[model samples]
Structure formats: C-alpha cells, structure tokens
Target chain A: MAEEECLTELELAIQVLVFNFYKYVPRRSLVRNKISKSSLRKMLQTEFPHMLTDTGNRKAADKLIQNLDANHDGRISFDEYWTLIGGITSPIANLIRQQEQQNSD
Target chain B: MAEEECLTELELAIQVLVFNFYKYVPRRSLVRNKISKSSLRKMLQTEFPHMLTDTGNRKAADKLIQNLDANHDGRISFDEYWTLIGGITSPIANLIRQQEQQNSD
Candidate 1:
C-alpha cells in the first residue's frame, strides 16, 4: 500500500478501536463476572468506607450510571454503560469519541 | 446457542472493547490532527487560561502525557498516547482493561 494508504488504514484501525470503545463498551448491558454498583457499594461501605467517602465513590457511581444510561430507563444496558464510563472521563478517550462522531457525520 | 454461550460472547465482546481501549489508545503513536501539548498549552494560555487554571488543565495534561507515554520515548506513538488518557480514568473503562488482562493471563 502507498504511504498515504497505510496512514489511512491506521486511521481506520484507530477508528475501529475508538468506535468499539465509545459505541460498544458504553452500551453493554452487563459484564457477567464484573462487579456491579450495588455489590461494589456494599463492599466499599463496609471494607473501604474511607475510600467511599474520600473519593466520593457513591457520587461517582451515580455520575457513571447517568452518563451510561443514555435512554434514562433507570437501568443501563451494557453498551450504554460502557460508552459513558467505558472509555470516558479522560481527554483522549473523549477525543476518540469526538472523532468517531465527526467521522460518522 | 446456549444462553451461557451468548453471555460468554458478550463477555468476550466487552473484553475486546476493553483490551482495545487499554492496549491501543493509550499506546497510540499520534492522531494526525489532534491537538498537542504545546499547542494546547498555548491555546489555553491565550484563549482559555482561565479554564486552564480553573480545572488545573495544565496539570491534567501533564498527568495525561505521563500516563500515555508508556515507553517514555519522549514522544507518544499515537497508540501509547491513547491508552493513557484514551479509555482510562473511569471505573468501567478500567474494568474492561482489568478483565482483558485477567483473561489473557
């Protein structure tokens, strides 16, 4: 492939990664083995109450759920969960999201 | 397919998203048109210095660069760049990462 083509392909590869990160992960309804908020909260409340209080873990979880629950159905599907909290909360992650959005348009 | 298989597949899908987020983005060599530190700093200094100070943007950028520069080669390959700030800094995104690493091992 030409140099430009390689770059384009890499760009595409990057996009695939980004789309998966932004679109797929956030939207996932659940991860079977992964810990859930209620479980984590319970664990934190007892085992690491300091962490919960210091990090504002409860509030953070709320924010995470709000961001992921795109439809506001009171519960997040796994995909919506990932998008909001999956690859989010960082500038570069947001960059991937912003780029994918731009590309789709 | 059995219900178990579907759940496993979804778990795998989630892993792929996480592995890609953690393994790829923070490790990126570069994004062609994305803003750079110096440029961002300059922009912030001029146009949005207030925001820079307000959110500790400069510090956040510093933290971002450090996290992404995995190889410490002085400049980020976009891949390395993405991983650090790409899909990190969130509990859910990090969960993807933690799972993928666990699965791989």
Candidate 2:
C-alpha cells in the first residue's frame, strides 16, 4: 500500500510475481482462487510473451499447464504457478551467470 | 545490459530473484555455485530485512536454512533457494488477498 519507490527491487519483484497470480485468477469461479488453463495461457501469452513464446500457442500452453498442475486438476494454483516461474527462470539465471563468467574470463 | 526503464515490473522482479541467488552463491570452491549457510543468512538479513527479521538472528536463520536445505547438504542450491523464497511469499500473498477481499466487501 505504501509508495512503490520505498520498496527494494527484490521486494517489488516479489510483489509483481504475487500480483500476477491474482491478476490471472478467474473471477466468479467455484474454485475461488485458482487460475484456469485458459487464464494461464492468456497470462503466459500476455505477461511472458518474450520468454514463453515457444509455449504461447494453445497446445504448447496446455502442455505447460499440464506439467505445472501437479494435482491433475486442470488448473494452476499459486504453488504450481510459482513452480512454473521458477522452472522458467532457473535456466535463464544459469545462462546469465555463464555469460558473465565468459565475459570476465 | 539494457536500460531498466524498458522492463516490465514483472520482468524486473524475475531478474531480481535470479540475481539475488547469484549474489549469495559462494565463489572459488569445488562447489562453485552454491550458497553456504553463512551466505544465505547474510543474504536474508540484508535483502529481506523487513520480511525476515524474525530469522535475522543466527540461530533462527540456521533453523530456516536447515528447513530449506532439502538435500541436507548444509548449503543451498538455486532450486532450494527458490523454494525458500516461494515458501516465504505464499502466506504473505494469502494474507494480502484476505485483506483486499475484506476491504472490497
């Protein structure tokens, strides 16, 4: 609720990840607080267009949703969503480190 | 790197999370890319001071680190580190949602 400038970049980043989950969760659902597969696809296509373009298509996105939906409930819960993001970011982080090392060397 | 102004808040946040892990990982070791317990504690205290002050003390931080060291190797890999951050954020996100719902109602 405070001004955005007061928060550290890390703190703000965590907020964005959290807020993105809420932003995609469907309204008026019996499930209440989960993201439907369609919503998950839309979110990837919109919020992560550059990173997830390979999975941006409906079929690829469906596969991604399936992988993340550990419960096989056909929906993406916050935990699943977090796991998905972690999965995506881990390799990128490794690549960045590798590049930095190469540059320094 | 490109200018920060070009990135979405979400994109920047992902970078922060990724960069934080690299920031704490130890260098010049056989285990070249892992975070030792001391590094993890220092990171939590410095980077998450507001949210993790309860674990700021060495003992509590040790306990937290033990729980996160899923492999029980006494150090944190990037995966373990991501899990720790996810664990910390989940409850906070729930609380925020509850508060928002109450306010809206």
Candidate 3:
C-alpha cells in the first residue's frame, strides 16, 4: 500500500502564486522594492474581491497570511512573496489579453 | 488603475491538476481504457483521504466533480483527464523518490 505524500508541481505553482501575492504585507518595512505594499493591497482589493468571502474582509486576509507563511517562520521571505503576484511572463500574453478585453469594453 | 483580468499560468496549473484528478470519475463508461475506473477509485480512497471533508463522505466527492467539469461540456477530454493524475512524468524523480521512501520504510 503506497501513500501519495508529495504535492504535484501544480500545487507548488498555486503555493508560489499565493505566497508572492501576500509576501509584502507584514514585511513592508523589509522589502523596500519597486512595488510598495500599499500598491499591492490596492491591486488585490480592486482586482480580486471575489476572493473575499461572506464573513467580511478579515477572514480572506487571514487565509492569505497562513498560506504565505510557508517556512512558518512567523514571516514571509522575499522570494516566497514575489511569485504570488506573477501575472505575466512575457510581452505577448500580458499585452494581448488586456487589449482583447478592452476592445469588448 | 489597471485590473488583473487573466489567471496566471500558476492558476492554470492548479486547474489542470484538479481537473485531471476527477475527469475519469463520472464518465467511467466512456473511459474504458488501460486504467480502469475502479483503480482510480481505490487510489483516491486510499492515497488521498485528506481531500475528503466528510459530510458522511458525499460533499468531498461533489467538489472534485465540479472542478473537472471545466468546459461544462458534460465530458472530460483524454488530454484534460490524464494531466490531472500526473504524479510523475516518468523515470528519475519517480523511481528515486519511491526508492528513498521504501528504504525509510
């Protein structure tokens, strides 16, 4: 009887995405990068409010915090955080999808 | 203020993984292949019990079904389905990890 103990790479992708999205919040003081924490917060609030649930805003943020605490060091690392917000990898898929949606608008 | 309208590749990866996992389930009759539906059933029941949330065991199975129905076409494609159960791409990682686990056992 063999047990499936490892996560699929897809799960790893999801974990990385979630981690990158929230890596900035608590560690705002540490990561003085090009993207600011306030900017990230605004992006999340406006772009993905569906992620928030029936219990109001706090619970959604709470789940995010738990997911990003991957090392469970009570904090999110810089690498652990950036991959969460990866919306595009290139010039084409990035620009094309947006242009298509805007044309319909 | 630009909004993020597209899912990242990472989300697509998650979608593919969950989709592949359940594609074999409902359309068992159509999928009379090398891997029988019964084997899949045993695998899910044994390998991944953590996926089940246990409302006496029905809701967990229900959630899995919904994820695999990506097109809502009422059928899962062979491509969509196989990618879901991809625990390995064969060879090294597969054999090495298994041997390590067995040695520990």
Native contact fraction per model: 0.00, 0.39, 0.08
Predicted complex 2: DockQ: 0.41
* Local distance difference test, each candidate: 0.39, 0.69, 0.39
- Could you tell me every candidate's TM-score relative to the true structure? 0.23, 0.81, 0.25
lDDT of 2: 0.69
How good is the docking of model 3, by CAPRI class?
A: incorrect
Which candidate tops lDDT?
2
Which candidate ranks first by TM-score, i.e. highest?
2
lDDT of 2 by residue, A41-95 (tens): 7777677655444323445445656776656787777878887777776666676
What candidate 3 gets wrong by more than 4 Å, as runs, is A1-61, A64-72, A75-105, B1-5, B27-38, B41-105
Q: Rank the candidates by DockQ, best first.
A: 2, 3, 1
Q: Which stretches of candidate 1 lie over 4 Å from their true place?
A: A1-105, B1-36, B55-60, B69-105
Candidate 3 accuracy as lDDT: 0.39
DockQ scores for all the models shown?
0.03, 0.41, 0.10
RMSD of each: 18.2, 4.0, 14.7
lDDT of 1 by residue, A1-105 (tens): 123233332233333333344332222333432334444234324432332343344576556555544444444333443343333323334444455556656
- True-vs-predicted CA distance for residue A59, candidate 1, Å: 28
Of 2 and 3, the candidate ahead on TM-score is 2
